[model samples]
Target: MNATATFDPFSPDAGTHQGGALDGHALVQGDYGTAVLGYDLASQVLRDKRFQNSALRLMEEFGITAGPVHDFRARSIIMLEGDPHLRLRVPLARFMSPVTVRNTRDVLRRIVESINADLDDSAPVDFYRGVAQRIPSLVYCHLAGAPASDAPQVQSLSERTLSLLTRDRSLTPVIVEAYDELFAYLAGLIARKRAEGLGDDMLSYLISLGDEGKLTEQEVLTEATSMLEASSVNTAHQVGLVVWTLLRDREAWQRIVADPELIPAAVVESLRLFPRTGVVSKIAVEDVELEGTVIPKGSDVHVAVWSANRDPGRFERPEEFDLDRERNQPLTFSTGSHNCLGQGLAKAEMEEVVRHLAEHYPDARVVEDATRIGQAGGRWLVDRLTVHMKP
Candidate 1:
């Protein structure tokens, strides 16, 4: 179940069944050195002050020393540590906090309803293309004060940029090429927004950082584009995953549709069962011992998020998907200071779609089985999710 052996996190027995390789270890040696698979230990690695993301080190590993892509990674709040991370994250978090998300709920609901209304249920409709991919990208564009017309461009570039992190080496050139176009597009948008004065939007918030002397022009550009890229890609794919999972079970789908109140719990359970990001990458800064395993300093640590979410120790019948589970807590978003600041927004986006599908297309079902794009550690991603909305 180590990284070297190539395990699919989406497989039925990944962490649920007894005697599985991944389930047998607190820490297992893998291609990335030591991997923490146990729920408790994985949580420790994520929250521990001794562990940090090696973005610069990763750039070296990927042989991306200097470029727009490299520059973005270096300045990214998600990649920074200590004060630097906090400095950028605090203001950005305020803009995307629960209150902000609640304010935007009406806008998000309208977007979802508008998109779902156009879906033709007569034939197999590609949910990935028609709905999942567009919603978050458009919403992000609107929130950033960018034109809604820019969504298609954002979708293309963000998806390609994310390919940089995939295990597929062939996508490196695609990623590099994407950075060129993405950087130029975002830079132009930043310039225009700057010339026009600020607005009540996320991009305006970043521009204000420059005005306040808290962030430089380049820092503002990098952070704004990075947030756009991450939020769209992460939230879009997650919506697809949740839809695919729910459609696979008629009874579960009916239960949620029958009671709209269950949409939130259903979304939560989907996240637990099929976390969008399968692994949280980290590097140990110093020697650390946890659960009887000692991880030396400078070792690459891959926290198995998918496995940890399904750990039998914390969850009863961890293999099963139950929306009504009385007590459920999953580390799908990781923990501690680095926990997803966009969770509130992500949840609202997800819940909106789920609620729409339940209320509008209660009889919808998967027209064809979803297919995985590749054999990467994350297999929950549905390359093509076609659903047929038949009454």
Candidate 2:
């Protein structure tokens, strides 16, 4: 059945009215083209090899430039497939190894401490700008071996690129400019690292790999920029949303504060309720049958993570934010080959920040009603989360 309907996937009510797996999936006429929206179907599409991350190509097809923005994406691991995908991902796996995680924990803890120390206690603080926005950039930049001085500039460029990437619109000159600036920055960063000799950090690791001929200079830049983008972009918004979810819910906050061990579970539940990266798209390489519907070859299918995470069939009382939910699996990170490579780092950032707040500000609560902002790209972001806490 082909039903052409316009949908505001980015709307504040995007997932609230959705219930059950059956209701989660639908074919809607989107601004770019047709899109598939549903939990079970979206999960399947993500895991299916036939459904691929070809959005860059699709954008080009729709008259977007194949310039620096496209070049970076094409070279980045995100767009690679099959052997090339594995080849790019293999060495990078070292960055997320058990040893790396253990090493980064202290850095993350310190970042939380620093951010927390700068905030005023009694007045309502804009957590989104003051705290959440700073964590990802600082943590990821520290891990990437980039100089602290470079973060503000890199961060500004990265945010613009991310916004352009996720939103649905014609590519504007501004985004293209961001890509040019970012490419130059990453390239220059690599050159400096090579001149100074390599260190053990991710940037230096990639440089070493390039010297050994495992990756080309362009590929190295792609990898470094990919890490910068992954580590700095979505995670900040996720951190904010998760914190909002817990603090707004008194019971959930208390549970986490009482048992610090429950912090991880709270993070998971927050992801389920309000996934920050709400939608991911894939192109069907061949005709695919999903939930009694046939998605034709070349079709652009949008996997709505926001709807998927809240499917009633997948979770009991899907709307309720229950930290103790027994089966709390979420597709916020996507799945299959293209699943998020920075999941571990992102999780660590979320857990550490939430744990710090729970311990230090037990009585903390959102001072004003939070506003939900929707992006044209189907992202549900928390606009301003003002929280009242004791010093």
Q: Model 2: per-residue lDDT, tens digit, 1-391?
A: 5535556565656554464343334556555555556567667778888887875775575456566677777667877788998988987886778788778999989988998889887788888888888888887678778877776776677687766655545655666777678778888887888788888888888888888999997788888777776667688788888888888898878878889999889899988877878778778889987656677898877777887787776788888888779968899999888888788788888999888888888988886555454444567666777888763
What ranges in model 2 sit over 4 Å off?
A: 2-12, 22-38, 61-63, 166-171, 370-376
Residue 386 in model 2: lDDT: 81
Candidate 2 has a TM-score of 0.92
Q: CA lDDT of each candidate? A: 0.78, 0.76
Candidate 1 lDDT over 1-391, as tens digits, reads 2233344343445544331135355677745567666688788789898988765566656777887688788778867878988888888888888888989899999999888788777777888888998998888888899998998888888888887656566677787888888888888888898798779899898888889998888878877877866768878888988888898888999999888899889999998888888778788889987656677899878777887777787777878889888677788888888888788888889999988888878998886654443225543566878888673
Lowest lDDT 10-residue stretch of candidate 2: 16-25
- Give the clashing residue pairs of candidate 1, or none: none
Global local distance difference test of model 1? 0.78
In every candidate, how many clashes are there? 0, 2
| Pairs that clash in candidate 2 | 24-38, 25-38
